[model samples]
Target: MTTAPASGFQTRRIVESAAACSGAVVAGLSLMVPLDPRMMGNTSALEVSLTVLNAPRSAAAGAMLAVVAAVYAMIFGARVAWCASFVAASVLLICAIAISGPVSSGSLAIVNFIECVTAGILVGALAAATLRRPGVGTAYTVGILCGIVIGDQLQMPEAGAAMSRWRWLYAAAPPLWLSVLAVVLLGVGLYWHRDQAPIVSESTVISNVPLVPILAGALMLTVVTTTSEWTARYDFGAAGLVCEILVLAGAALVAALLLPGQDGTLILLATATASAGSAVVAVPHPRWSWSLTLAALALGFLAGRLRPAPLVAAGLTTALAVYAVLTCGIAHTYLLLPVIGCTATAFVLGYAFGAAVPHTVSGMVLGIVILVAPCMIVALRGHENGTVGYSPNWYRDPNGTEGLLPPIVAVAVTLGCTLGILLLRQLRPVTAGHIRRLPGRALGGKFA
Candidate 1:
C-alpha cells in the first residue's frame, strides 16, 4: 500500500498548531515578569512598598482588558489582534525599562499594569485563535505550561548571575530581550502563514460575541481580584468580611455569566477545585521542585494524549494527591511524599484541564479565569489567613509543611462538590427541551 500525501487541511493544521504553540510560549514568558514575586516585591524605596506589592491587583485589571481583547480578536481576526497586542506589550516593556530608575513606585506600578494588560491581550488572542482546533489547542495549553516553568527558571538569581555583564542587556531579566525577539520572529512567521487557517467547526465560531455577559464576567473578575489583593495587604476589623463577600459574589457572577448550564457548572467547579489543590504542593527544595514539575507536566501531557474519560476522575485524583502531600509530613523532612504528591497533582490536573478544555469563546474565558482565580484567592488568603498552600511562610528555606488545614478542607470540599454534581446529574431526569445548546460540550475530546 502506498502512503497518501498529507492533505492541504492537514498541512494547515500543522502550521497553525506550530504558530499557536509559539505564541503561547511567548505569552507565558511575557506574563511571568508581572507575576514574578521578586519583581513585584522588590522596590526602589522603602516608603513606596504598597504600590509595588500590589502588582497582582494590576494583573486583575489586565484580566478585565483580556476579555475585551478576546472579543476584538474574534471580531477582527486573531492575526491582527495578536500583532497589535505584541507591539503594545513591547512598547510597555521598553517604557518600563526606560523609567525603571527615575520613575516613582506609583508610576512603576502603572507600567506594570499596562504591561500586564497588554500581555493578557496577547494571551487572550492566542487562546481565542487556537482553542477551536483540537491539535492546536493541546499544543497551546502544553506550551504555555512549559513556558511558565522555563520562564521562572530563567528569572532565577543564579541564571541572572551567570549572565555577568550580559545581564545588564535588559533591565527586567537578561533573557527577556531574547524572549521578545523570539516573539517578534514568531509573529512574522504567523503573518507569513496567515492564510494557512486550521479546520474549525462552524459551531465554534462566535459571530457576535456576547457583550453583556462578557462585560459582567470581566467586572466580576476585577472586583474579586481587587478585593483579594486589598484583603491580603491589610487586615480588616473582622477578617475582611465585605471583601470576602465581594470575592465570593464575583466568582458566582463569573460562573453565572461565563458558565451557563449543568455541564458548564461541572467544568467550572472541577477546574477551580483542581487548580486550588494543585497550588498546595510547592516543593520548596531548591532545584527539585522545578525538575519534578517538568516531569509531572510531561506525564500529564502523555495522560492528556490518552484522553481519559469522566474528566472529573483526574481532578479528584489531583485533590487527593494534594491532601496526601500535605498530611504526610513536612515536605522538607519527608522528601518522598512531596515528590509523589506534587507529581500526582500536576499529572492529574494537567490531564483534567488539557482534555476537558471547551471550544468556545466563553469557554476560553473560563479556562483563563480558572487559572487566575485560584492563585488570586490563595494569595488573598496568604499563609497567615490560612494555607491555600501556594504561599509558604519561609522566605529562604520553605519547608512546605505549615498551614495544612485550609488546603485539606479546600480539596475535600472540591471532592464533595464533584460527587454532588455527578449525583445531581444522575438523579435529575433529562428533557430534550430543557438542555441548553452551548457552543461546545463541557469536556472536549472523545469522552465529551
Candidate 2:
C-alpha cells in the first residue's frame, strides 16, 4: 500500500483550527488579570512605554517556539520535534521560575501564572498541528490542560487592588490574546502549506536584505530614547512632534520601497505602520490629529488608484516637508536657511523625480527615500527634547482668551498636504505602457 500525499489546504486548515483554539484559551486567561492605569495615562510617552511593557512575554516566546517547531518539522519529523520542544519549554519555564525565586508578591504571582499558562497553550497547540504524528497531539493537549490546572492552583484574592486597574486589565487582555492567536494561525498556515512552494526563498525571508530590520531597530531605538527623555523632563511638545514627523517619513520611505511591487502586502504594512504611528501622534490632539491622519491615508489610497507614481512622490515630499518645517532651524543649523527656501523647491523636485523614475516598485521606493531623508534626519534630532504637545490648549472666555489654533492648524495643514499629493498623483501619467501587454503577449514576446 502506498501512502497518500497530504493536501496543502487540509494541512492549513488543521493548523489554523489548532491555533484558534489555543488563542481562545490564552485570551480567556488574559481577561482575568488586572489592568494598569498608568498604561493609558494622559502622556503619550508614558502610555507607549507602558503598553510595550504590558505585552505578554508569551508573544515573543511563542514566536521563538514557532520557529523552532518549523525546524523540527523539517528535520526530525513533526511528532518527535513537537514533543521535545514542548518538554524543553516546560523545563526552561521551571528553571526560570527557580532562578526568579518563588513569587513572593501575590499580584506578580498571578500575572506570571497567566502568562505562563497562555504561553504553554499556544506552544502546545502549534506543536500538535505541525508535528508529524497524531499521537503527539494528545500529549500537547494534555500538557496545556495540565498547565492551566496548575495556574488555577495559584488562587486569586477576593478583593484589595483598585477596581479601575482590574477593569482596564480585563479589557486589554482579550485583544492581546486574540492578536497572538491570529499570529499563531497565520504561522501554522504558512508552515502546513510549505509544500506549495514559496515565491521568495526562506533564506531571503530570514536575511531581510531589504533593511526592514534596520529600519525597525532604528524606530525601536528612537522610541526607547525618546521615552527615556520624556520620563526625565515630562515635556514632549516640540520634540514629540519632531519624532512623529520623522517616524512618518521613515515609514513612508519603507512603504514606498517595500510595498510598491505588492499591493495587498503593501497596504497591510502601511496601514499597520500608519495606525501605530498615528496613535502615538494622536496624543497631543486626539480628535483633530487622528481625523487628519485618517483623512491623509484615505486620500493616499485615492491617489494610488488615480496615479500611483505621483501619489508616491507626493507622499515622500509631504513627509519630508513636515519634518523640515518642524526641525530644520532648531536641529539642522547648517542647512536651515537652504532647507527653508527648498520648501517650495521640493514640489519641483518631486514632480521631476516622479516623472523620471521607472514605473517599478523599486523606483518608487528610491524616490521616496531621496525626497524624505534630509527632513527625517532633522525631525529625528529635533524630537530629542522630550516635551510633546499635540495641539495648543485653549481656555474659554467671552473676552477672547483663547489660543486653540495651533493644533487645528496642524491638522488642516496635514490634510491639505495629503490632498495636494493626491492631486499631483492624479495628474501624473502611468508611463509603464510599454510593459502593459497581456500576460500571454509579454511571455511570448520575451521568449521570441
Candidate 3:
C-alpha cells in the first residue's frame, strides 16, 4: 500500500537518465575499439594497448557501475552510492592489475583478464546505479554488456595466435569474473534492500500460479535433453525422472498456499508445452528441429496471450531453439536417434509434471528441475568424451571431416521443432484452450 517518497522518485529518474547515457556511450566505444588488433605485437605492446583501451571500456562500464551505485544511493542516499562506486572501481582496478601479468608474459597465461576486469568494474557501477534509481531498471546495463560480449566473440578470429589467445581468455577469465561480479552485486543490493518494502507484489486472490515450478520444469527439460546427448552412454534417466516428479510436487505445494479461489493450471499447462518443445530440440532428432521451431512459435504466441508465465516459458523455449540451431547446421539429417529419444523423453516428463503442478509454484520449480537435471546427468556420466572436435572446411571440403553428423543433426532438429511449435501456437485461435490455458490465465484476463 505504501508508495515511494517524492524524493526517491525524483532521484530514481535522474539516475535512470544517467544510466541510459552511460550505456549508450559504452556500447558505442565497445564497437569502435578493436580488441584483437590493439593487443597484437609483443607482450609489452599488448599490455600497453590493453591499458589504453581500458579508458574507453571503463567509461562504457560506467553504465553498469552506475546501476550498483544507484542501488546504494537509493537505500543509503548519494553518499553511499559514491562510496560504493569508489569501492567497485578500486576492486576492479586491483583485479585487472593482478591478472595483467599473465596476459603479458607467463607460462600459465591469463587471457582477457585485463579487458574483462575493466569492463566488469564499469558494468558493476552502472548496475548499482541503475538499481538505486527506483524507476530505472537493469535492462540497459544487461543489453550493453551482452552486446559487448557478443561483439567481442563475433569479431575474434577462429584461428592463429590472436584467436588462440582470445579463446583462452574467453574460456577462463572474463566469464568467471563477470559471473562473480553479477552475484556479488545482486547479493549486496538485495542485502541492503532486504528490509525495504516492495513496490509491487501480486496477491493470491488474483490467481495462484507457481512461477518457480514452471521455470524449473522448462529448465529441467533443456538440461536433461542436453545432458542425454552429451553423455549418451550414461543411465541418468531415473534421476531425471525423479527431478520432474519433484518439480510437480513442489508446484502443488505452492498452490496449496494460495487463496482458495486461485487457479493457475492454465499457466502450468502452457509452461509444460513450451518445456516439451525445448526438450524435443535437445533430443537431436532430425525431425525434432522442425518440432522445436514449431514449439517456439506456439509458445511465443501463447506467451503474448497469457502474460508473465507464458512469456517466461516462451523465452526458455527460444533459448533451446537457438542452442539447437547453433550446434546443428541447417541439415536435420545429421541428428542421431538416441539423442532425439532422450530429449523427447525429458520434454515429455517435464511437460507432464509442469501441467500437473500448481500455477503459483510451477514456473520456479520447473526452472530449477530443468537446470539441475542435466547437470546431475553430466556429473554422473563423467567427462571422457568432452573434447572438442575440429572439422576443416566442413562445408567446402566434406572429405576432411572429424566428428559425426549426429550431433549436428540433433541441433538442427531442435531448432526446427522450436520454430514449428511457435508458428502453430501463434496461428491457433484464442478459443483453443490448449494454448490459451498454457500460461494459467483465462483468455479474457489481463491478456484480453
Candidate 4:
C-alpha cells in the first residue's frame, strides 16, 4: 500500500496555530503596559531597580502557577484557564482606568505593583498552558516582556493638560485597548488551544541546564544593559535609540560569524567578557579602554572553538574580577564602551542558545532565565545597598551604580557561564552527526 499524501487541511491548521500564537503574544504585550511604574509618578529609580529583580521571581512563580493551572485544566477543562486569563486581563484594565484618574496617596502605587505581579503570574500560566510549540510559546513570553524596552523608545506625550479635550479617552485608551485584545486572545485560545499538548524534543532530553549559571550571568547583563541604557541616553541623538538597536543587530551579525562552537561555550565566554569589563569600569579614574574591553569580548566569542574554552574563560573571568578589585580607584570617559562590548557578547550568546535548544518549552524556560536573571540579581543588590544614600561604596562611583550593581553582575556572570558550559557538554550529539533523545531525561537529561 502507498503512504497517504499529507493533508492540506493539517497544513492549514498548523499555519493557523502559529498565527494564533503570535497574535496571542500581542495581547499579552498589551496586558503588561499598565504594570510599568513610569506610569505611576513615584519612585521611578526604585521601581527600575525592583524591576530588575521582579522578572525572574515572577517567572518562577508563574511557572509553578502554570503547572497548577495546567493540572487543574486537565482535571476540569481548558475553558477554566481561559476564564482565569480573561478575568485577570479585565482587572488590569479596570485598575489602569482607576489609577489614571487621580492621585489618592503613595499607597495606591502598591495596588499597581500587586497588579503587575498577579497579572504576570496569570499571563505566564496562560501562556504555558495554551501553547504547544516551544518557538510559539517563547514568542508569546518574549513579546510580553518587550513592553518596557519598546515603551522607552516611543514618543507618547504624557496624557497632559493640553489633551484635556480627549482627557477621558487618553486615560482610558490603554486599558480599553488591552481589554479588547484580551477578548480576542480568549477567542483564539478557545478555538486553537483547547486540547493542545506539548511535545518533548530530543535536545531537551539531553540538555539538562541549571539556573545557577543564569544567576551569575544575569548580574553581568544587568550592569551592562542598565548602564548602557543610561549612558546611551547621553550620546545617541533623538535618533540615537534607533541607532542603539541597529548597532546591536550589526554586532550580532559580526559576533555570530566571528564565533562558532557549542552554544554553552559561547555563552560562557560572553559572561567572561562581562566579568572582565565590569572590574575595570567599577574602578575610579582608569584610562577609557573600550578597545581592551571589545578585544576581550571578541576573544571570548572566538574562544568557544578551542577544546579548553571553559577553563580559559573561567580563568579570564576570575582574573578580571581580581584585577578590578586591585585597581579600585580607576575611572574612565568611554564607560559605555565596555558595556557595549559585553552586551554584544551576551546578545549573540542568547540567540545562539535559542538556535541550539530543540523546539520545546524547556527552551522557553532557558531563554527567559538568560534574559531576566541579570535584572533580578541587580535589583536584589539595590535593595541590599539601601538607596545609595552616601558616596558610592564601590567602583569609586559618584553615581553610586558601581556599589550596588557591579558586584552582583560580576558574580552572576562568572557562575552562569561556567555552569552553562558544563551543561552544554552533556547535550552534545551522541555521534558525529546524529541526534539521540536520552530516555527518562526530559528535564535536561542529566539532572532530571
Candidate 5:
C-alpha cells in the first residue's frame, strides 16, 4: 500500500516561518544595541535613561499602537498591506537614522529612541503574525533570547587612528548591520508571504473594541514603570520597597481585571517566569557566559520544535525555581552555580516563552511591560543588598553581586507562574471567544 504524503504545512512555509521568526532576533539586537555601554561611549546617563527607562515605555506605547492598527486593518481586510507598509516605512527610517553619526548626547538619544519605537513596532508585528504558529513561534521566541545574549556578547571595535575617511561609519556599524539584517529576514518571511491571504475574515469579528480595558492596562503599565524608574534610581529607601511591591501587585491586578478572561493571567504568568529565568543568567563572565547563552538558545530552539505542552513548561519552570533557590542560598559561596544557572535558566526561559506565546496583541504588549517594568527595581534591590546574581548595570556586567533579593523575587514569580499554569489546565475556557472579538462588541456588532 502507498503511504500518503505528510501534510498541514509545506516545507516552504516552514522556511518562511523561520525567516519571519528570526526577524525577532534582529529586532532584539536593535533594542539592545543602544543599551550597550560600548555603543554609548561616555553617554552613561543618557544611555541609562534611553535604554533602561524610555525604551520600555516607548516600546509599550508602540506595541499598543500596533494592536490598534492591526485591529483597524483587519476590519478593513487590509492587514497585510497595512502591516507591510508600516514595516517598510519603519525599516527605512531606522536605516536612515542608524547611519547618522551622533553629534551630541541629545541627538543620540533622539536617534536611539526612534530606533527603539520602530523595533517595538517590529516586535508587535512579529507577535501578531507568528506567535500562534507553533514552529514559527518557537523560532521567534528562541530568536529573541539569542538576540539579547548576542547583543551583550558583541563588542564594538575601537576607532583606529589610521582610518580617517569615515569615523561615524565605524561607530554606527553594529546598529546598521542589525537594521539591515532585520529588513532582509522580515522581507523573506513576512513580506514575501504577503500575497497569500493568511487571516480569514470572520463574521464574528467584534467591531467596537473595549477601550476601557485597553486604556486601563496601558495606564497601569505606565504608572508602574515610571514609579519603578524614579523609586529605584532615586533611593526611596523602605518606602520604595513597599511602593515597588504595591505597584507590581497593581500591575498584575490591572492585567487580570482589564484583559479578557484568563489571557491576563496567562500573560502575567508567562512573562513573569521568563523574566525571572533571565535573572538567573545575568552573569558577567565573558567567555563562559557567552558560550552558555548560545548553547541555551540552541537548546531552546530544539525544545520549541517539540512544541512542549503546558506541563512541560511547568516542569522547566520548576527547574528555574530550583535554580532561583540555589542562587538565593549559596550562589555567592559557589561562584560556579550562576554559570550553570545561566545555561539552564536561559534554555528554560526560551522553552517557557515558546510554550506560552500570547494569543492576542494586547496580551503580547502587556506581557512585555510585565517583564520590563520590574527590571530596574529588581536590579536596584540586588545592587543595594549585594546579591550574587543580579547585575545592576543593564549593559556591562562587572560581576558585582548586588543582592539576593532579585533571585528571591524570581523564585516567588516563578512559583506563581507554575501554579497559574497548572490551575489553567483544570479550568474550562472562560471567555466567549478570542479577544479579537472584543473589537466591535461594545457597539452592538452582530455577534455582540
Candidate 6:
C-alpha cells in the first residue's frame, strides 16, 4: 500500500475557512456599534445616523449584500469574488465617510448602511466559500457564531457602565474604534484565507444535493436564531452557565465521535442535542455566553474534520422548526419554553447552518434571507405596531406585546410548513457509510 504524499495534509483548507469564519464573527460582533442604537429605537450619540439604518434594516442590508457577494463567488469562485467585494466595500466606506459626521442626515445613514452592508457581503461570501472545503464548514460556523456570543457578552454592560469601564476604548468614537477593528480583522481574514486553493482544485461542484433541504435548513436556522436572540434577551445565571457549557462540550464530543461518515445523520443528532440543550439552559446569560461560544468553536473544530450531508441538514432543520413552532405555540402556557426552546434552537441552527451551508453561497443567502426577513418585518412593524423584536416589549411594557402571539405563530407556522413540505422530496441518507462512498456529496456533488 502506498501513502499519499505529505503535501496532501499540508494542503488542508480548514485553517483558511476557520480564519474567514473568525472575521465573519468579528463582523457580526463589531457591527454592534451601528446596529444596536438602530434597534433600540434611538439615535446614535456617536455619529450622523441614517434614516433607514435601524438594527433590523441594517442587518437585512448586510444579509442582502452578502448574498450578492456569494452569488459572485458562485460564478467566479472565491478569489475573484472576494477581491471584487473588497473593492466594492472600500468604495462604499469612502462614500459613507464622506457624508457621515456630527450632523445626522438620512443620506449619511444610507451611506453608513452601504458601508456596513459591503462588509457583510464579503463576510457572507467568505463564509460560503469556506464551506466548500471537505471538513471546514463547521469551523467557519463556530467562528461566526462565537463572534456573536463575544459581542453580546461585551454588550451586556450598560452603555454608561461600559463606557466608564472601557473608557479609553469607548470614549473617543467607540464606533470608529470598533469599526476599524472589524475592518482589520476582515482584512486579516481575507489575507490569511487568500484562497481555498486545494479544495478548489480537488472539488468544485455541488452534486445531487437537494436544494430544498438546503433551503429548509437555512430557513429553519433563521427561525431558531431569531427566537434565540429574543429568548436570550432575558437572563439565566449559574445553572444556565453550567448547562450551556455541558451542552456545548457535548456537542463537540458528539461531532468528533461522528463525522465525515454519515454526514446528514451526524448533523441531525448534533442539531437536535445542541438545540435541546441550549433551550434547556436558556441564553442571554451574562457569563456563560462566551463559554457557550467557546463550546461552539470546539464543535466547529471537530465537525470541520467531518463532511456534511443534505438529508440530515433537512431533517434536523425540520425537527428544529417543529420544535420552535411547538415551543412558541405553547410559550404562554409554559413560561420556560421560550427561553429554553429559542436559545436551544439558535445554538443548533447556528451549528447546523455552519455545517450544512458553509460552502454554498446561494444556500447561505437563502438561509440568511429566511433568517433576516422575520427580523425585518418585526423591526419595521415595531415602528408601526409598537412591538419590540417580534413578540412585543416584555422587558419594558408587557402590554404592548399582547397580540404578539399571532404574528409569532404566523411566522413560525409559515416557515415550518414550507420546510416540512420541502423535506418530503429530499433524498434521505440511510447510513453514515454513504459519507465514505460519496464524500464529494459534501461538496454539493459538483466535480470539476
lDDT of each: 0.50, 0.32, 0.33, 0.38, 0.51, 0.41
Cand. 4 Cα-lDDT: 0.38
The local lDDT score (0 to 100) that residue 165 gets in candidate 1 is: 66
Tens digit of per-residue lDDT, candidate 1, span 261-364: 44344344444443354434444434446567667876775665466443365355546646644553555566565556555655655665554443355555
Off by over 4 Å in 5: 1-15, 36-38, 42-53, 66-102, 132-134, 148-175, 188-220, 234-243, 257-261, 287-325, 328-335, 358-365, 372-393, 415-448
For candidate 6, the clash count comes to 18
lDDT of 5: 0.51
lDDT of 4 by residue, 143-165 (tens): 43333112211222333435455
Q: What ranking emerges by lDDT with the best candidate at the front?
A: 5, 1, 6, 4, 3, 2
Task: After superposing candidate 3 on the true structure, give the runs of residues whose Cα lies further than 4 Å from its correct spot.
Answer: 1-78, 103-128, 132-141, 144-157, 161-327, 331-448
- Candidate 3 structure quality by residue, lDDT tens digits, 127-239: 33443232342243223423332231122222354344444334322233443444344344434445644222334323432233223333334433443333433444545
Residue 238, candidate 5: alpha-carbon lDDT: 62
Which candidate has the highest lDDT of all?
5
Model 2 CA lDDT for position 438: 11
lDDT of 5 by residue, 1-448 (tens): 2333344346656764555545666555665555543444455564545445445455445545544443433333324633653474356446555445444555555665666566655655565455545566556656656765555434333335355465443233234544565566566554445665534345544545435445645665566556545644566666666656556645554555555445555454554554455455344343446567677767774674467455576666666755665665555456576667666766765665545444454555455434433444344543442321123334434344434555555555555555555555456354565431112222112111
| lDDT tens readout by residue for model 2, 1-448 | 2333457545555665565344433422332222222222233444333323332232223323332333322333333433443443343334334323332323343343444344433343344233223332322222232222112111122235455533432233233433444454545544544454323344544432334322332343343334323333443566565555445444433433332232212222222222222111111111123223323433443343345453454355445444434432332233233223222222323232322333222222222212111122212222333222111110001111112222222333344434533433344333564331112211001011
* Worst lDDT 10-window in candidate 6: 390-399
Report the alpha-carbon TM-score of model 3 versus the true structure: 0.33
Q: Is candidate 2 or candidate 6 better by lDDT?
A: 6
